[model samples]
Target: MGELVDFFVRSRNFILFVLLEVLCFYFIINTSNYWGATYFNTSNRYAAQVLAWSNAANQYANLRQVNADLALENQRLNARLTQLLQSKPAAPAEYQADSAFADRFKFVVAKVVNNTTQFANNYITIDKGTDDGIRPGMGVISPTGVVGKVKICNRRFSVITSILHSEYLVSSQLVKAREIGTAKWDGVDPHLIKLNDISLTKPVSKGDSVVTSDRNSTFPPGILVGRVRTIGVQPNRVFHDLTLDLATNFSSLSFVYVVENRLQAEQDQLEKQVETEK
Candidate 1:
């Protein structure tokens, strides 16, 4: 206690000088308009910076909700787009049905929980299921293009047969050449698929767009499937050997939309009855 008292006694002058300096500075800022203004401006800038950091944190926290909302909006737009694509462009405006009545397909936005592209029979798992109206044979699409077809569904989730699967096939058409064919995975390249049955006489070329064909019932017509990557001619083969760069990058899949055909059940029943009779 005695040593502490002695130390304070020795430093008391310096402490008093420091306190006086602070007091003088405070008084000068408060008494001078210019100094006060500068002080307030500096304080305000610090406060503004703090608020900005807080706001950025809040926005980062809300990102998941933002992604979900964007997904839903995309689903609605895609559903509307399908209607427009189904309409005949040559038909008169009078033939165009009202948007509400013209709706032939509904889309359910789903988050990808799992996906595989490294195997011959790759599959994708999504965070939606029968409860969300997803069912076997329903089509899935990403924002850029066709993704896969639903393979199985439970109450809360579903599995999809990825377009990369060995057995997966989609009826596709060349946009520029107007040739119809089947798009299938060769089980070799993750980025390339084969366009089979396109006749060699067709005008297919590199970079030509491939899209879902009208004959496919699983997915709506005209959805992008791929772009022609290469072409080859084989002796004794009537069809050209064609390769496509798949549109969907399955390795980076994050979200997708499941397509529901409003007329699917009706069409399936009619086709079944016709086969029964035949």
Candidate 2:
């Protein structure tokens, strides 16, 4: 207490000067209209700036929740689009079957809990499983494009065979040429995938957009897979050597939607029965 008193005594002159300056400013602003208006305008501007900064900080803090909500909304939109694409206008005899397929797809939004892009066989793990209606062979996709297929599932989690996997295949098509081919990774580049079975005589070109083909059982038809980055001929191969720029960047994948095809089991069983008979 004594030391505080001594310190205040030593700085008394400076403190008095500060008080006098504040008093002078107060009197100048109160007595002069121009000074008061200028002071209030400057203060208001500073106050507004401070409030803006505060609001921005709040928004930044809530960004994760905002992203999750947006993903869920997109899941619904994507599900509806897939249903529409699969359901075409049918004749009266087939109207019931078409109507059944109109709502046969369901999309579940799941957070990517794990991902790998550096390996020859990359995989992704999501925070959903059989309990969430996820199943092996279900298709997974990001907001921008194709992701992978579900390989395994538990009650609350599922592992996906990413499109970067060496053995996984996606049925893809060139939008302009309408050529269907199998898209596969060569264990080389994560950004590029190889599309096979496109004839060299066909009008293949760079910058052509590639998308999931309608013959696929996994993803709905027409989901973007990649764009053609190069088209060339291999030395002894029968098909054109085409590379595509993948739409989904696996390195930064945060969320995905698992697509459930309600009729896939029946389709698979029918195909298996035909194969067995052969």
Candidate 3:
């Protein structure tokens, strides 16, 4: 206590001088509006800088929570989009349907739980299962284009044979000419698919739009598939090989709609009978 008193006694003159200078400055600013305004402006600028830094620090700390909220909101928006995309036309009052696939091509919203784009036989898994009415051969599509057909379904999850798979094939037709053929991926680029059996004489050109043809056993007619980017007509070949720029951006796929056809079993049985006889 005696040492502290001695130190303060030696420094008291300097402390008093500092206090007096602060008092004079405060009084000058308070008495003059111009000086007061300048002081306020300087203080406000510093305060803004401090607040900005604080906010940035807080955002950095809460980044994970913010990302989660964004993901949830995106999921909800995707669900709404799927609902809108799958809305069907109302049946007539006199029309009565008993079959599940015929009556309910219900769109079950599913998130892409797993995806692969680097393999020849790539497949994707969805969060939906048989319990959700997802069945084998049911079509899956994103907003941009057709995805693929369902390959396997478990009690709680399902796998889709993505259009990028080499085995994937869909009965598709050229929109401009109504020429029907099977579309398959060649396991090359993720953005391209192949249209087979389009006869060389069909007059297909680049940039031609291709869509699903109901003539096939799987997809309904007119689902957007892709657009033609190149056509190869080899000499003496029966069909023109078409390279397509697929409509769907497979890499960015997050949400999809599973098409549940109510009459798929019946149709399969009938088609099987026709095939056996042939």
Candidate 4:
């Protein structure tokens, strides 16, 4: 108390000067129309700027929540779409009867927590795992196109073998020519991949769209793979060399969906039985 009083006494003149200065400026601004207008304009401008910054900060903080909501909404829409596609009438008489087709795939939305595009064997990590129903061999895709396949999973996270990986192969088909082929990364460019086994006889050309083949058990048929960027044929070669621009930009991937085929286990078992007999 004594120290504060002593300090105040020493600073009294300075305090008084500041207080009088403030009062004089206030009275002058209030009395003068031009000054008053200038003061209010300056103050309002500063206030508006402050409010804008505050609002921006608030929005930035809410982005994660907004993204999560969007993911859930997308999941709902995908489920509804799957149901509608499967509900189509098979035959005129069977239209009234129970639909033979049931929803075979379930989609789970997940955020990409980690990704790599530069490596020969790239991988992605998502914030979902066995607890979230993610499993090995499940196909992964973004809103734009296919991303990868789930490779490993635990309780709360799963790793995906990215489509950019050199060894990754996806069954693909050319849209216009209906030519079936295998899509694989050449380990040279992250933006491009090669589609092999397409016969030179097929009407493949630049700008042709390629998509997932119907024969794929993991990925849904007709999902976009990429567009043909270059096509070349070697002498006496049966197949044409195709370079494609990948649909999904792996470098910018954020959100992806893990696809679960409900009948995958059954299909695997049947295939295994057939293989064993052969």
Q: What TM-score against the true fold does each predicted structure earn?
A: 0.81, 0.92, 0.67, 0.82
Q: Where does candidate 3 stray beyond 4 Å?
A: 1-104, 273-278
- In the predicted model 1, the residue pairs found to clash are none
Question: Model 2 clash pairs?
Answer: none
Task: Please tell me which predicted candidate would have the highest TM-score against the true structure.
Answer: 2
Which lDDT value does model 1 have at 53?
100
Model 1: residues >4 Å from true position, as ranges? 1-50, 89-102
By TM-score, highest first, what's the ranking?
Answer: 2, 4, 1, 3
Q: Which has the higher lDDT value, candidate number 2 or candidate number 3?
A: 2
What are the Cα lDDT values of the candidates? Answer: 0.90, 0.90, 0.80, 0.88
Residue-wise C-alpha lDDT for candidate 4, range 156-177, written one tens digit per residue: 9999999999889999999999
Q: How many backbone clashes does every candidate have? A: 0, 0, 6, 0
lDDT of 2 by residue, 97-172 (tens): 3666666678899999999999999999999999888889999989999999999999999999999999999999
Residue-wise C-alpha lDDT for candidate 3, range 27-98, written one tens digit per residue? 999999999999999999999999999999999999867755665565455444434433432346666544
Question: For candidate 3, what is the lDDT?
Answer: 0.80
